[model samples]
Target chain A: MTLGEQLTETSDALLELILAAEDIEQKEKLREQFDVITESIEKLVKENVKKNSKEYIAVTHNLNAANQSIKEAIDDLDKIAATIMQVAKVVEMLGKMAAAMP
Target chain B: MIKKITVLTLSLIISGCGLSVTQREAATRFASASTSVGDFSAKEFAAMRDVTIQMNTKDIALGGKAKINDLDGAFDVDDVAIRINAAIALSAYGDLLLALVDDRQSRDLRNATMQFEDSLRGVSGRTLSDADLDNLGALVYNIGGFFLEQQRAKALKQIVLRSKTDVDHLCDLLIQDFNPTGLNLLHAVDNTSKRLKVDADMALAAHKDNPKSKLFAIQAYRLADSQRTRVKKTGAQAIAVLTALKSANAELVNALENNSEFLVDTRLLGVKMKNLGLALKVFSGS
Candidate 1:
């Protein structure tokens, strides 16, 4: 497969994995693994392209687009984390009240 | 009459004219909870605040190398700036709690109670019927207990209000700063990875064509490896921080939910105050 195609496939898979990851640790691991794949793709693109060539500019643009999608996915994950934190705070408060009970 | 006067004078001298040490100690103890409760709340808030500040500082430092000349660096810097702003919000929350604990309201309440106790001593040996003396003692007990309860309720309310505010601020920070920073950091890391991959691939291709390019390819691979390693380290740290924050947030929520127990029953205080009024009425023979 072409580098762009590989990246598109990888990005799709990572997004699905991130969305399905219920555990914070699991999500983080997925993100790290995704980073490795993207890095490899980036290397491939760079190796095959010549400066000012159509292939070079096209791959860069594709990479940028893929990165944007990844950012959106990460943002979704972060939102989930923040929600968890907020819920945790509420639970903590309830616990304190319970402890205070006579 | 002479014998009675002599005994009364001796009793007055022994008890410091009705202001006994025991009475003062009891009164002080009753009011001391005001400060103690405030101190406890402050300590708890500080613990959470410290952890939050540390996380934000780390994020900010991670982005500090971002420069306009370097796309990744510039992006990272902006991400860090968002975290710093969130940290400031967290700091504000901490400050409000500290202020609530250190406020003079508690001290003022204690001093007023002490003065009231001192004044009450003046009525200790007044010429009154047995019924009147009993009423007077009851009045003192009712009023003193009521005062203590009042102070406690006030302290509790302040703590609760401040705590709620802090929680709200935390939520806001998460939305405004934490979420955005996380996205930005991810983007920067992805961008960096892509750049490093390009270099490594280019070097490898060159080496395939010319043996002299082998060293360059090796260096490129090493650099890419280092970049991946850095990402792993940072990812681990971020996870750890978020975990701690999540835990702290949970604790806070539990505390808030159970806050009903901490709430002072002002109605009970009202009853006590009413009893004081009734005791006074009996003493007045009305």
Candidate 2:
């Protein structure tokens, strides 16, 4: 669990213990103080997560590979059929020249 | 010659038939859904920041110890920027997957895989380890390059399988950030709504004697109530979107593994994404 979660759990456990206190006078006073402590703990937990989230997000590398370079490379691949046709034409002309020489 | 033409045509047909129509559709739908989740989260993070500022403003107006100068430091702009970039990166990840199966656009799967390697190299400094790079290289060049060739199904499966761990990690991070239960984005929004309602209640109580002021206060209260409900509903929808995004990737992998038709789930996920988009728009009041 995260530190924030652990703090929250601990705070809840403290609240439970406060609720189960046997001494009535002390229990009431402690509950009031405990409420303030719980509230502070809640805020602390939120801030902790928020601070950690920044670091988490910062390390998230962009996994998107479909950019200008990739698209251009794919576009070049798309011209393969036309390039093959040019190669075929050159080969055909060579065959014709060979026939003429014979 | 004529023989060459016949051989090329036969090969094209066989390659095209490698992935079934249902499989292609499922992959496409999954890509779209994941991309939507990414786009939504990116925008939602900005909205969350705005809501935080508004909450701070309300707290000050309610007689709390804060000033206008404090508003400037109310939010972490750098953190929000990183969140937005991370979300966009996620969308880009989906685009990479779509480019693999999308025959009309990316016919040469080999080049696509290579391009991804080049792109990964560019971003490697930020996060990817050497081991991660080697594994990615192996996945792209060896499994994706050699055995899969240009076969869409096998290539997509390889990409999805290779990306599943990262995808889960990313999704989990986002889920934690947006989870309604914790003191995250949605919780902040909920608190903002409650603060607004408190302001409205104060207005109502203060203006009880003046009829005109009372009318305006009542309107304010109604607006606050409406906003609170909208926030609640949108919070639920946000969770649903994230859940669907994670499940869609997992289900796509499963469908590919079993070679089963999972169109129904994809279609449902698509609709859910659309609904969440609408909900978000309503919540944004844009």
Query: Which stretches of candidate 1 lie above 4 Å from their native place?
Result: A1-102, B1-70, B73-80, B95-183, B204-223, B243-247, B260-286
Off by over 4 Å in 2: A1-45, A51-55, A62-102, B1-18, B62-75, B105-155, B207-224, B255-258, B284-286
Residue B4 error for model 1, in Å?
25
Q: What is the lDDT of residue B276 in candidate 2?
A: 82
Q: Where is the poorest 10-residue window by lDDT in model 1 chain B?
A: B175-184
The CAPRI class of candidate 1 is incorrect
lDDT of 1 by residue, B53-95 (tens): 3322322323211133333332233334333333443343333
Tally clashes: model 1: 30
DockQ values of all predictions:
0.02, 0.08
> B51-105 in candidate 2: lDDT tens per residue?
5576546545544322466442323676667778878877766676576556543
What is each model's TM-score for chain A?
A: 0.45, 0.39
Candidate 2, clashing residue pairs?
none
lDDT of 2: 0.57
lDDT of each: 0.37, 0.57
